[model samples]
Target: MAELKNRQWLLAARPAGMIKESDYRWNETAVPPLKDGEVLLRNLAFSFDPTQRGWMSMDTYVPAIPLGAVMRAGAVSQVVESKKSGFAPGDLIQGMAGWEDYTVTDGRGMLGLQKLPPGTDPLLALSLLGITGLTAYFGVLDIGLPATGETFVVSGAAGATGSVAGMLAK
Candidate 1:
């Protein structure tokens, strides 16, 4: 149909004490053509987490977000164009889409792009069914390994991951 303009928030500078609006710069650019094994996605939802601070400031499990690059964040997106197998137009997917209206990927990153089952809620897919849920699932089932009827204590039970961990423990 019409041409697409990709809106983006690029990392301008690393934070000093706390993050500020000036740390990022807004930009809009033309969506690039897809190459083989790549898929173009329109972001629908974004996941904001405390770990993103680390990603912006220092090198952690993943490298820090480079200046002049899109600020990193996980997102739920819909495929707009695909040169990759198993992904097609209109498919809903989740992965590291950063702070952008559009993203192009080859299903590779910290969490590779994954297709959402039909009718899945985008918000739920990015939250409880995404990294937060996966972290709770692994912690409670794999690491804690609490037996039935055993008391499971979850700190920060009001937070995202902890709340899910508490629920999964039940």
Candidate 2:
């Protein structure tokens, strides 16, 4: 319970053009003991991308963040405390945990009870093999439906997914 008193960064203001670190604020919150089906997790690492800025925009994603809450960021974390079934300490997970040293979540929207793939570095997944890979894989071959050896024109051509899509198209 004393640990919950530690601080975190909440979304101080929704970004206007970009998410300068100024658009966020530090939150000192209590790390309460878990009630049924809740878990306390220690923040590890997270992924950041351009679409996250879009999520800040009222036009693109869900409602904009109200000032003074944890800024929107995805995270990989470890369970330090749990009151849920089928989960325990030391379990690694991924989800939108925000910018905090610790977080308490009701085990939802999380994936990964299994270890990350061998040598498939999660950071690489953050780039080449993660969301970027999915974006590239679906964009060219799925939605756009390129024929064999057809030339593909791409915007953001040097970006994470576009580069992969261009290479894949060749």
Candidate 3:
């Protein structure tokens, strides 16, 4: 196969309310050579969540992605090359790989590199079994703490977390 180029969507500016495509600047960068203990991942899909907007804000659980930085995102990707022990070519994994089509990692803290079982569905990995669902599960069960027969209120009832929260509430 031909050499793979890395394509990325960078945060161009902070938005006031909702985000638009113009808020991002697309650019291609050279994929760097692998270093010892590093693995190259080819991103397959990204999760669009409300927290992404929060990340665009001035403050969040993590520092906001800086302007000109690749927009922060969680992705499902396949290992394309590996210098790491547990990760090998063709292994599917989940992590915070950002908006780039490719990412390189040495499996450090919070990068949260997790290898999926063979034949595991990427859709499931990106959804019900992913952060979105886990967030909903915790937010509803732990944080919300609604008792049986208690009414549950979800503000963004149409969103991924909200929908899961709603169902878990019911």
Query: Highest TM-score: which candidate?
Result: 1
Worst 10 residues of 2 by lDDT: 109-118
Give, for candidate 3, the lowest lDDT window spanning 10 residues.
104-113
Ranking by TM-score: 1, 3, 2
Model 3 per-residue lDDT tens digits across residues 31-120: 888999999999998888777888886776778889999987778999999999988899999888879988988877454898888888
After aligning candidate 1 to the native by TM-score, how far in Å is the CA of 116 from where it should be? 0.6
lDDT of 1 by residue, 9-93 (tens): 9999999999999999999998888889999999988999989999998899999999999998889999999999999899999
> Roughly what TM-score does model 2 have, to 2 decimal places?
0.79
Strongest candidate by lDDT: 1
**Winner on TM-score (1 vs 2):** 1
TM-score of 3: 0.88
Report the Cα lDDT for residue 5, model 2.
Answer: 69
Better candidate by lDDT, 2 or 3: 3
- Whole-model Cα lDDT per candidate? 0.91, 0.69, 0.86
Error of 1 at 132 (Å): 0.6
